[model samples]
Target: MLRYLSIIFCAATSFSIAAQGVVTLDSCRAMALGNNKEIKTAELKIKQAGYQRKEAAAAYLPSVDFEGAYTYNQKNLSLVDKDQLLPVKTFNPLTQNYEYELLVNPSTGQPVIVNGTPVPLQMALLPKDALTFNTHNVFAGAITVTQPIYMGGKIKAMNEITHFAQDLAISMHDSKVEDVIYNVDAAYWQVVSLKAKQRLAEGYVSLVESLDNDVKALVEQGVATRTTLLSVDVKLNEAQIALTKVNDGLVLSRMLLAQVCGMPINDQFTLADEDKETLAETTLRPATFNMDNVYAKRHDIHSLELAVKIFDQKAKVARSEMLPTIAAVGAYHAMNPNTYNGFANKFGFAFSVGAMVKIPIWHWGGLSNKYKAAVTEARMKQVELDDVREKVQLQVNQASFKYQEAYKTYDMTCKNLRVAEENLRMAQVAFKEGVSTSDEVLKAQTAWLAANSEKIDAEINVRLCDVYLSKVMGELKIY
Candidate 1:
């Protein structure tokens, strides 16, 4: 019972969430831009680049650190006096007497004196005590200010690279948005077109059903032959089949729309009447396009430019490794030893500032190799930029040509639809006046339906090609 209640509660919450959302083309685009996984991932990369840029900017600022350490060390100190081992002599300058003194003679077993005075000979032995140290914790805090005196332009170059990376991220995001907008427009319009086709098919089927009833009634009245009734039956069957096909197509189109909206296919949805009309009238001719402008403004091109900048900066950073980096440093420390200072804290502090230069003397060709690779990558990006520009030009040209063709087809189809309508009307009146045969009327009706189908197809193409052209021109969202 509790599990069922929990399921019911979840279901209610989901329904409430879904009820708040209204699906429109603009709304769908906004939702996809905000919530689509791909777009969201791209946005996250942009954020990451932003943080990296911030980190690069922060490099120019001062830094502070708090450090603490606990040390337990033991040491012993010993010293020997070498002066005691050497022989001692006494000299009297006034008496001019010089003599050596010995307390005992090994062979004579007697003391020897110099200058009528005996001096005792002795050796002194001393022991220096060993020092033991206990654990001593040292806590110190220092505010270190690192003002970049010079970095051989490496820091500034890196910051520029990071800024370029941020720009690249933004461009990538725009590229993804363009792609999503195009895809969604395709799906949304496809579903709308399919729905219109389905309605047309249903209308044809209804007309066939009415004709079938008339044929049956005529056959019963002995005015229509069995062959004529059979013909009408065949037409009815064809119309039913066409309707079935269109219904299936509608279902599929709805599924695709759901996919674009990032919703479940099981969700029930339909296009608004105004949306259907608006989609039918979509055109791209008003959008301005120039191959040169497109090449200059393409997001992909901008992204590549940023990539080249980053690679160039990478080369600069590598070159910086070969130059000397100078820094000034100062330190202070305290010591405590049991034997030396009776386990008392001896504190000391020192302050000094000096420049240091570290010259790179030799490497196993590592720096050279890295610099070479960076240069190669930067060069490759330049070639890639050209290739992408060519491709973008081709896309724009192709889309423009296709749009023109679709427009022509739409115009021709409109004229053909009017002719088919007149032909169908003339055939119906002639059959009613007992001049044209049922077969002729049936043929005219078939022609009219086919013409209508062609017009619908042409219109669909016109709208789709317009979307394609708009996308190529980078104006999918703008218009």
Candidate 2:
């Protein structure tokens, strides 16, 4: 049992040493960016857009394709049917046309006829086999190259659209980065705030415990009643309970911050600001901003502008379908049984080059309607962008005002905390001298806790306000 206990103790101690680290804000932001699903998806979208742009650009170049086929025929092709015979003819000088040489009978002075046809003196015979042609096996193939000469500017517009699409994807990625930074900053500050409160709670509990001991001493000396001791005991119990609650809250807040950093929810980690008494505290200064510059730098606005450009290009593509299209085509063809050379029993090759043109006469208003719809969609996107720009302007102004107000509140809380600290000190001194009631001491302690808590909140609020104002002004960046 001792050996087993030793092993467990060593493992826990090693884990503690390994888990110790001061995680900075920049580190958390980097981890979140690396682990975020949205950021990875946005990266893939940018790559996809890049490939699509390349595809569009390829339309400007010629495309080559090949097709081939083979077939079998049952019989050969023939131009003539069966054997044939021809009569021999002789040319006569006195006559203009050729005269057939007719066979004359010995007893008849004229010609001999068989079945009402004259008999020629000589005839030549052609066999059926000589008229047959071999065409049983056939093969054909062609390789064609087509290049677009003109398409009413559709190709150019498509390429432009893809380029803008890539830009849009990049802008969206920037927007997601800003969102991630905002979330990390919020969770990080929450943990810091909770840590400060936890420390405050511990201090208050200790102070109350010391007072309880002093009151017990008073009771034993016969200078204070049991009623006074009971009251002090009750306040001590309340302070202990409050400390317990703050510790539990701090644990949960740490869990939230860990989750936001893309770490395991149950993992143990420390924040850089957790040990510090102040949170996100820095010198405050008045600031001025340029709305035009903010609008220009905003990722959403840039994405919307890209959307408008893409829609306009789509309108052009729709209109291109209504205009004339032209292409240059060249091809090489090869066929068996060589028909180009008297249907010989061999393969023959041929090359051809030509241009094609298409003119759209009518489409029953279909193409026209599509183009009009695209134009309307582009216009709508433009109007939405304008509206969002105005809203962003208002949002920046509001956030700026809130940011300044947070600093002012912080100043007031600081002064109040000082006053509460002084009052608590004075009350404790008077109570020790037996000149003040225990009730006054309790009130002073309570006031001190409230003031300290408010100051912590004010400091955190200032940090939050700064984050939001930077977000609205498009100043939050990944770096």
Report the poorest 10 consecutive residues by lDDT, candidate 2: 1-10
Best by lDDT: 2
lDDT by residue for model 2 (1-479), tens: 24224434543443444267657776677666656788779889989999999999999999999999998999998877888887878887789778898889889767899899989988878777777778899889999999999999999999999999999988898898899989999998888888898888888888888888988898899888999889989998999899889888888887887777667888777777789876546666457788899999899999999999999999999999999999999999999889798778888999999999999998899989999999999999999999999999888888989999999999999999999999999999999989998888888998999999999999999999999988888888555
Best by TM-score: 2
C-alpha lDDT score of every prediction, in listed order: 0.71, 0.86
lDDT of 1 by residue, 1-479 (tens): 24224434543443444456535565555444544688668878888989999999887765544455555435332344232334456675876886554588778888877888665464333333323223344333333444555665678888989899988987887888788877877787677777777777887888677777877887899988999989988998999898898889878877876777677877775454314533446544843466776766667777887888888888888888777766554433333332234554554443444565667778998877887888888889888878887888888888889898888888898899899999988987887777877788788889889888888888878977987787777766621
Q: Clashes in each model (backbone N, CA, C under 3 Å)?
A: 0, 0
Give the C-alpha miss distance for residue 168 in model 2, angstroms.
Answer: 0.9
Once fitted onto the true fold, the runs of candidate 2 whose alpha carbons sit more than 4 angstroms away are: 1-20, 71-137, 283-288, 342-345
- TM-score of each prediction: 0.80, 0.85
Considering summed lDDT, which 10 consecutive residues are worst modelled in model 1?
Answer: 126-135
User: Could you tell me which residue pairs clash in candidate 1?
Assistant: none
Give the Cα-based TM-score of candidate 1 against the true structure.
0.80
